[model samples]
Target: MPLYLLRISSEQTSFRIPSLLSIAQVFDFPIRFVSSDLFRGVLVVELQREDDVEKILERDILVLSATELFAEGASYDELHTELRNNMALFDPYIHTTFRITMESCNHRIPETRQRETINTFRYTGLQGEVSMKAPQVEFVIVEDYEWEVANTPEARYARDGNFVRVYFGRRIGIGRARSLILSHSVKTRTYYGNTSMDAQMGFLMAGQALPAPGKIMYDPFVGTGSMLYAVAHWGAYVFGSDIDGRQIRGKMKGKNTRPGVYRSAAQYGVEDRFIDCLTYDVTRGPIRRGGWVDAIVTDPPYGVRAGAKRLGRKEGKKPLREDPYLMDDGEYSHQKPDYLPPSRPYELANLTLDLILLARWLLVPKGRLVFFLPTVNEDYDEIDIPIVEGMKELKFGAGSVQDFGKWGRRLITMEKTALDDGLPPTFEDHDELELTKASGKLPGHYGFNKRYAAGFPPRKDGNRSESATPPNTTLEKREEGME
Candidate 1:
């Protein structure tokens, strides 16, 4: 195994380690630990080969770069001594055109100091031509400055002794898949709603699902096909089924009449992998039970932003109204092909439970199920995730919260261990987030707690900020033909 250094982005610190580990877990790559405190902007690991490092870089959204470690020490004097002690490490790049790239965390190293540092490492006895642009081999020196220091400080205050640790390595690869974050950004997309998944978060969610070439993926609560595009870019043939048809169909129609999801697929150059997004409620979903789909990734709508809805009545014993849904000839009006059905609020806990069962029935053995669940951050450090037979939830953390106010959502990933051989077990619903563990009275997640009622403040127009799932004017206009 070759020892490697990974320069991780400081953003989403909790997700960085898990993101890399998920890629390794998916690809069966062995990542042995070589450092103790690994998550602080720098990671040192022992990988099988350069190929394994590249495999991680292809899908990991948090890791910035991967390098082959040569030598490292706390100080520049100690670094040079370590380099000379193992001078054979520099033998391969001695006669080749090479360049040394200096990088520092917590403080910006001036170009003058950068040149001085590069010159200091010249004692490696490398009599090679210096090529900055197209180097045959590139070595990187990273300085891990004191984290307590003020971020974005003046370079004059950037002292050499301020650095806690330093590393010297040969640059092997960078996180090229990070480009997908910007390429599929919401701002750059053709059809995205207010609640559509963020590009970075979309990639993060998709990575957890372990999407790969020839993998069959699906998103049941696919809004505007955001999750679909993210998986499709990774060579997975992704299909999205939404309860609302309007999301699949373009809201805008005039000259270029392509639909939203499909149009975005073409624009993203992923049309080949973009399996059509059909309209259907997940509760009455048409998908057959089988070990077919490789992965299932989606952001199930919470109460706010995107109101979770399913086909049926708003509230009542019977699903239909008192008025007979039939024609003069006694034919069911809903049987008329163009008829649209009414929808009701699909609660959080129930939706989470249904998704687990659906994944158990639909996914192949070891196939992943990745989705989001909102929880009250103020209540506890961790929410009790859904526990079920044959559906194993992988532990990442309590929840990656980033200024989510009082409550926030976390991405939950589980794998279908085996086909359902027994009946679904139920438990007492003491907590709102506890899903399948339900037996007695079920008030549901958001209905009772009302944690999100004060989430998004009301707008001047009286309607809350959640305008994503608005009143359907088309449905309101169809009073005589309403479902």
Candidate 2:
């Protein structure tokens, strides 16, 4: 039997197992699929027999990491029970002792070598601790490799003796684009209206969730087409559109554009012919009707960046200004002014509502709309769009900043329903909608949340103490050492 690895998000282990089981049933695989945590929140499922691994791709398949698996539609208790049941069925052998072998190359180490060394070390150390008490012994070894040696005199003159080490630890999602380009030598650029990984993760998670071949995926807010590259790598018919004419023309024309997107595409074996890049505004234009879309996954702007200008105001102008009000007396009262078109947040909210409503018009009823919705003051209750019913929200434990240290964002999945007869009334007024006040101070009222949920602590304040344990800390530390 061929070995098949099923990767899922960290906290989503509960849903990942069931999804694996479902895949097993769909593929008609016999017996049980062995599952193990590759790292914290990352579950790897090895099919009991991989005889028909290719067949699973024929259906709409998703390989979720443990973190994103159960965040939606399931409770922790339910997932725990399922996990225990699955473990009982598998009769897995619990490995308590961890052997950590640190091997180093004598020559100047490549980036890949350094990464492998640190990852292996962390994995052996942390995973061992999880399975048993403490990883019994850590072994370190150093070896000289060909890449480390300089053959020419000039090369020898510039050579700095360095050892490349290898190890393993918890693996987290580095946005779909980063993960896809991890093994490649090409440069990568992410196109996003909201420059945050939260937007990228939704696309990444959706890419992991959806089946390849015959499935069509699109991102309406493909500011730079970052998400487009991720889904396209999985052999799906990827389509991307942005309201910005310049971005589309730049990408299409290939003039003075960053070579990363094209280079990465070539490296991934996806040529320009495979991707469909277009320019269109979801709020104003139609999304080429008559074709069925399997998934509409995107991160609409939070009215912070690109969407701010579209909020009907000139750039750099405040939506609300404070004006002095003179009464009969000499005393002046400060009056809060209103927006010319309205604040970008309100305008973007309306645009988002329009997109959701329009997505329903375009999507095959029951199609999934997965997106990263910005929270106002950390409050979600303020969203009062009747068009978006059956809303499922997943709080990514860690914010995007924990991984990239930028913005904090959340994941929301809403399914298009056919029974729209009894929907609630839509609120046209922005002021009428109830806004929820976040308990803690958020970075920006409208910027992308750099802190993703995967690395978030159970308590908001707990994150402060556990700040050093970020998923990419090892990588960052190693990079610094190399520099």
Candidate 3:
């Protein structure tokens, strides 16, 4: 095994490690981390091959660069001693065109002092040409000031340890995977909405789906094709369905000022892989069950700016028309060109449970279900995650939280370990695409939406009261019985 130092971007520190681990699992590459700490700015890992490290860097947006670790130390004196002792590590690059550079994590190394430090490292005798412009290889010296730094004295947790850590390695790849973010940024996309998925999160979700050539990925709550576009960019054929046709098609009707899901895919040159975008209510859609999709990735509406909806009319509401009438185009009154289907509120709690159940029947063996779960910071728990009998083979892979003051949302990756023979059949398989199959009564819990609006109330001992939490629903509880 070869050791490598992975420099991670400080942005979205919580999202950094899980994404890397997901990439490794996708490629079936075995990696041994020196330490499995979640927020380590610099990671030291033992990889089977250097080429595998490059492959990971090419897909990971969090990893800034990959380097072959020659030595590390707690102090400059110890660092030089270790580097000198392992002179053989630098032997190959000795005759090759190379340049030496110094990098800092929480501290800055002045250029004059960096040159002075590079001069002191002349002990490892070499007669290589120093080409800063087009060096065949680059050797980097990293000085880590740890979590505490001179900038944020208020956040200092403890007294600074001596030197913290230092690493010496040869750089291999830089900014390759990270460049994908700039390519899909919402600011540059041709078609986007107020609730479009963020570029970075979309890339992370797509990666979690383990997309590859010949694989098919789907998004049930696709909006403006953000998630699918990213998946298509990674070589997967993507299709999606949304309750609102305006999201798939253009909200505004015009040719020159075009705004549709297809335009966004074309913006990134992935229109070919962006197979289709249809309109359907996920709860009652006409999708036949049985492990057909390779992966399911989506950012379901959380009822903040964009609320969730299902095909159904509001309770106690009277129909505008008493009897159906044929129109001039020989169509029913409700089937007019301007007719809009009626819908009812679909809360996050039940929608999330149904999504998990849907994944159990829709994803292939070992396929992954990646989505976001928004909850109050004080009310969230692993037990709160929805699970059913069919999801016995569904295992939680990773969860990364994006905290916002009193509340936070977690990006959840649930992988289907294997097909569940005892799993129940789909409910909507034999039913028509109508809300008559569902009850009009709404659940007690409205999920993050109601809580966010009322302002999150802190829970005692990090546990939710039974009356306050949403009751779990299963496939058997619905009217469509499983046989």
TM-score of every candidate relative to the true structure: 0.84, 0.46, 0.86
> Candidate 1, residues 262-367: lDDT per residue as tens digits?
8888889998997778888877777655678899999888767667887777656566675648788778887874577887777676676667777877888889
lDDT by residue (80-143, candidate 3, tens digit) is 9899899998788778888898987766666776798789778877678999999998999887
For all candidates in order, the CA lDDT equals 0.73, 0.40, 0.73
Q: Which structure among the candidates has the greatest TM-score? A: 3
- In candidate 3, the residue pairs with backbone N, CA or C atoms under 3 Å apart (3 or more residues apart, or in different chains) clash, namely none
Candidate 2: clashing residue pairs, number: 53
Error of 1 at 220 (Å): 0.5
Give model 1's clash tally. Answer: 1
Our model 1 lands, by Cα RMSD against the true structure, at: 9.7
Error of 3 at 478 (Å): 26
lDDT tens digits, residue span 1-483, model 2: 322333333433323333343345434575334433233222334444334433333221234311112111123234335434434321222344443332333344445554564453231223334322344433322232234447775674465323221122221222223343244322333222234344334333454325355667777776555555556655667777765545443443345454334444555566552456665445444544622666677767654454422422344865444565575756554332211223233344444555565555555555656666555333323222223443222222221222222333444444555433223223243331122113232122222322232332233421111112211111011111101
Best by lDDT: 3
lDDT of 1 at 263: 80
What residue runs in model 2 are displaced by over 4 Å at the alpha carbon?
A: 1-48, 51-203, 208-211, 251-267, 272-275, 288-291, 303-346, 376-407, 419-483
